[model samples]
Target: MTSIAPPRLPEPAPAGAAPPTSAPVLRMRGVTRVHGGGATQVVALRGLDLVVYPGELVAVMGPSGSGKSTLLTLAGGLDVATSGEVFVDGTALGRLSTKALAALRRRSLGYVFQDLNLVPALTAAENVALPRELDGVATRKAYREAVAALTEVGVAELADRFPDQMSGGQQQRVAIARALVGPRRLVLADEPTGALDSATSGEVMRVLRARCDAGAAGLLVTHEARHAGWADRVVFLRDGMVVDSTGEPSTPESLLDGDGGSTAGGAER
Candidate 1:
């Protein structure tokens, strides 16, 4: 891997934000997300507890409506928890004003959505540089950072290509570079491989694994067991709660051989 400069610190973290040396990048305690009201109420998550430390990649797996997406939304500060607290870098999310929360996200977080939302009108490099520009980085510096990030993901040559000119896998890589550019230390990916073939999915997973190995914390929500294999740990969710967890990193072969086969609230070795 080519050496890239460390992320430049953004303006001082908002008041109440934890210092960068804090251990866990993300922490959720007794979080719950509810939808609607009255008889139409629906509980998307129920008292979920999750913690992701630096240099770790945790994969979340579950069937549809298992609250996997909901978890990402809450963790990224996109949605508020109905109850309980969510702390990113040790600062309580609910305590921040909208402006402070936005600043935190801009400086410390990266999110890759299932749809791989790249700006259609922008070239790959421009797309990747958008976040840094939004954070007030100089155009030249942000473009340089974009190229470095694209190179890190093996897509530097695609920097000038538009989304329409790239393959789905290529576009996905660009989205990742966009998320990874600058000094962000935490990434949350929700079904990032949904549009790719098994082979391309593996490629994307490899990039995510590499990022985590390089010291960024990652939270990946994936439906494919094989895709989950790249994570350091697997968390299985059922009805908005964690049902089982894997203690060791699983391989594609082991994940395909059997269901992790743990009863509720147990760890699968």
Candidate 2:
């Protein structure tokens, strides 16, 4: 029997060129998320619009309670927006059923939490394979893919070790392997380097940068200017709104200086 081929998605524009006419891998339009009732309402995000394209890594920086994590959660489909819309790979998140949403997440989205949520019982390879297993891939195939991802993140030697057997940096590398495994089109990382030393943090950023360079769209939330420098564009969020973004006229140097250029709020922090 002849195997049927899957449908092909449009490719992203090349880096440093004009914006692509194709749809973005991730898109948020007038997104808002409010918590609690009238007496205790807190708006986590308000009328936010953003887009992350393939081969692009966008850094988000802001002070505490500035909706950085909220925006990430919304983009990853872990939380619903109070209004407006979020689309991942051209699929509107709000329109999908719970099951469909879960499936999409398992197959298309990868998230690396700050805490590095690796299971104690599972080895590194097994942990990385879990998502693919949940998505119905065969056990052997998942493990093979897991090994490949582990090698990509420079942790193949630790693939058989459990989480407790590794250092914090090693565990974080395993977590990144899990996130980048499979055909995930969007990778969302929340302070992925928060627990590592300076060298380890730089290594992780290099890995993330290489992943984006290889065609995945990345959204990273970080407070450190050094970390955000790895991103192609830095987005500053304040009180759930995009206060500024870095572009041609506003160099990363100016942004770091907290000058009156495109880098206004988060760049200084």
Top-TM-score structure, candidate number: 2
Instruction: Write candidate 2's Cα lDDT for 2-111 as tens digits.
Output: 98899878894444333333446887877899999898999989888777777778899989998999999999999999999999998999999999999999999999
Q: State each model's CA lDDT, in order.
A: 0.82, 0.85
TM-score (C-alpha, index-matched) for candidate 1: 0.83
lDDT of 2: 0.85
Residues 1-269 of candidate 1 have per-residue lDDT tens digits of: 99989998788432111212335677787889999999999899988877776777888999999899999999999999999899998899999999999989988899888778899999999999998999999999999999999998888999999999999889988998888998888899988887888887787888888788777888999888898887777889988888887753222222332222221234312
After superposition on all C-alphas, the RMSD of every candidate to the true structure, in Å, is 12.2, 13.0
Evaluated with lDDT, which candidate comes out highest? Answer: 2
Candidate 1 regions off by >4 Å?
1-22, 248-269
